[model samples]
Target: MTDKQISDIKNRIAVIAAWIVACLFFFPIFWMVLTSFKTELQAISVPPKLFFKPTLENFALIQERTDYTKFAWNSIVTSVGGTGLALIIAIPAAYAMAFNSGRWTKDILMWMLSTKMLPAVGVLMPIYLLSQKFGLLDTKGVLVIIYALINLPIIMLILFNYFREIPKEILEASRMDGTSTFNEITQIVMPLAWGGIASTALLSIVLCWNEAFWSINLTASDAGTLPALVASFSSPEGLFWAKLSAVSTLACAPIVVFGWLCQKQLVQGLTFGAVK
Candidate 1:
């Protein structure tokens, strides 16, 4: 075979390999969704029944047992609220870091990134105590604030990278035109970098939406998110696989849909600085 034919064969092999990996990664989610429609006995059967008649009993039980709307609302409030707050803070910080340079700027950025490396459990006690002291436990406001703070570094870093890619000559010309800092960022920088900013915001929102740790640990009945609702399926009686799977499916539906809708932007943002 010619060299071109050999190259084509290699590309086909790579495509097949990628499809296998994708199926493996996606199998658990598919199983969970499928099991949600099975009876409890079928869900836990040793030899799983792949073609059993589907039932909606689990979903009905879940709806009757939990106030799903309340949990969903909490998730929406915390995730969106936190993302908005983080963007508000990160935009200016990234703008400044990108447009201006100082001796310690790189060090400061490294320090900020390092904070994400620390184990969250290590500081859980102090944060929990402080929340209680401030009467912020089981409050939507507290979740919003914590989520914003937790994701701030990542948001700033992403926006900073995108901002750095903007040509410095454009800012110089804007400065020469006597544009104020606000005007430059609002009119010039923002318009030019809108794609990056939008993708960053979407990613931050996704992260906040899927945040299980803080949502489960910090909030109780009044402020419990969908994750908390999923956890509530566990009881002293034992694990109800069917009901649990149904709750899990319901909890994941919104975020899955949101991610699917924004997947193009997500891909673009991830590949932003990868190419010239």
Candidate 2:
């Protein structure tokens, strides 16, 4: 066979492999949505039912059982708040690290990332106690702070990579033109790196939104997010598989739609530095 024929076959194999991986990753989400429409018995039947009478009863019951809007509002507030805070902090830090290098800069970055490797549960008690001592437990503000800290290293790292990819000469010209640091960032650097910033902010928000551990442990009804609401589905009696699926579906739907809508921007931001 010609070399071109071999290359074509390899490309086809890669495409098929990619499709299989995508489907595998997507299957659990598909099952959850399907199970949401089933009756509790059908959801847990000896053999999982793929085709059954779908119903809106679980969704309706979820609304009646809890304040869906309130939980959703909390989620929105915390995720956006956290992402905003992270960007405010990460931008300056990333800028310094990217442009004003020092011997320990890489070490500092590694240390920051190392914190994430520690199991969250290991420090849960100290954080919990501190929150209690400060009278900040079960508040949206506290959740926002926690989420920002949790996602900061990743945000900073992404922004740093993006910043490094930009040409230094552009900033040098601006500096020679008497541009102040604040203006340099707000006017020059930010504009040039908008794609990276947007993508970084989007990722941070998604991470914050999907955070269940802090949301469940720190917040009660007053500040509980959708994840907390999902956790509430468990009772002493037993788990309600169908209703849990229903709540999970509702919790996931908004983010999924938001992601789909902003996919172009997300892809562009993530790939901004790849070519050059």
Candidate 3:
């Protein structure tokens, strides 16, 4: 075959492969949303009926059973607050590590990253005890603090990588102009690295929003987040697939929508230094 024709065929195959992967990833989500509209019987029907009458009863039942707004508010507070706190801490830490490295800098970074390898359950007992001892259990502040700590390492790594890509001459020039440390970050590094920061913040926020482990174990009705609400649908008898699906959909909707809205920023931020 001619070179041009061969390239065209390869492109077609790549496109087809991409579509298949996308569909595979999206199918579970589509099924969850579809099942949310089904009745309990329909949700678990033999052959998994693709065609059935849809109803809002499951959603209505969820609303009637508990205060969704409260859970949603808690999720919003924790996710945004946690992400904000993590960024505030990560930015400076990453900046120093990137520009002002010492002999133990790489070791410190490795140690921070290693913390993530430890299963969260391993530390749950200690964390739970600390929370209880401090009278911070079931409080938004506790979740925010935990979320920030858990996400801190990744955030710092991401920001550190991005910061390293920046031209040091720009920062040095800022210093020559008598810029203070805070202004050097606020006026120069921040503006330049905004994309990476936004992408990191978005990722951290999503992680915080979807966190269920700590939320479930640490909080009760007072501070239960959306993931906790989804977990609440379970009982000893069995899972109510339909109602569970409905609540799951409600819980996922906000993050999904927010992600869609910020997709451009996410993409741009992730690819900030790819070309240059």
Candidate 4:
């Protein structure tokens, strides 16, 4: 065979391998969605019924008992609110770190990033106690604030990297034209980094939406998110497999849809500074 034929065969094999990996990653979600529509017996069937009659009873049951709308609203509000707050602070920090070099700048960035590696369980107590002491527990404001703070380092890192990719000469020209730092960022940096900013915001929103540990520990009712709603399905009587699956499906659907719709922007943003 010619070299071209060999290359074509290799490419086909790679494509098939990718498809298999993708299916493996997606199978659990597909099973959860499928089981949501099955009867209790069918859901737990030894053979795992992949082809069974679907039912809406699980969805109906959850609707009758839980305030799903409330949970959904909380998730939307907190995720957006947190991401917005994060961006407001992260932009300036990132810009400063990217442009202004200092002896401790790299150390500070690394320290910030290192915080993420610490177990959340280690600091959970202090955070909970402080929130309770300040009467901010179970409040949307607290959740938003905490989410932003928790996600701050990552947001700053992405923005900083994106900003660094911009040509400094452009900023010099803006400065020659008497542009102030604020205007430079607003007019120059922001426009150039728009793709990265958008992708960062989208990722932050998804993280906040999926944060079950914080949501469950911090909020009870009024400000509880969908992850908290999913947790509520568990009882001393053991798990309700069907209804639990149904609620899990509902909780994941919105973000999954959002990610799908914004996939192009996400890809563009992720690859924005990469080429340069």
Give the candidate number with the greatest lDDT. 3
lDDT of 3 at 191: 91
Q: Which residues of candidate 3, in runs, are more than 4 Å off?
A: 1-21, 236-238, 260-276
Error of 1 at 137 (Å): 0.4
lDDT (10s digit) by residue, model 2, range 138-245 = 999999999999888877777888898789999999999999999999998899999889888887777788899998888899999998888787774137889889
Off by over 4 Å in 1: 1-15, 235-238, 267-276
Worst 10 residues of 4 by lDDT: 267-276
lDDT of 4 by residue, 167-229 (tens): 989999989999998999999999998888998888888889999888999999899999888
Each model's lDDT:
0.86, 0.87, 0.88, 0.87
Most accurate candidate by TM-score:
1
TM-scores vs. true structure, each candidate = 0.87, 0.84, 0.86, 0.86
| Clash count of each predicted structure | 0, 0, 0, 0
RMSD of each: 2.7, 3.3, 3.0, 2.9
Cα TM-score of candidate 4: 0.86
Cα deviation at 109, candidate 4, in Å, is 1.2
Error of 3 at 221 (Å): 1.1
Superposed by TM-score, candidate 4 places the C-alpha of residue 205 at a distance from the truth, in angstroms, of 1.2
Comparing 1 with 4 on TM-score, the higher-scoring candidate is 1
Report the lDDT tens digits of candidate 1 across residue range 1-276: 999999999999999999999999999999999999999999999889899999999888887878778888999999999989988888888899988968887788789878888888998999999999999999999999998988888778778888998999999998998999989989988899888888878887788878888888999989998988777666842378888888899999888988899887776555543333
> Candidate 1: which pairs clash?
none
| Off by more than 4 A, model 2 | 1-21, 41-53, 236-238, 260-276
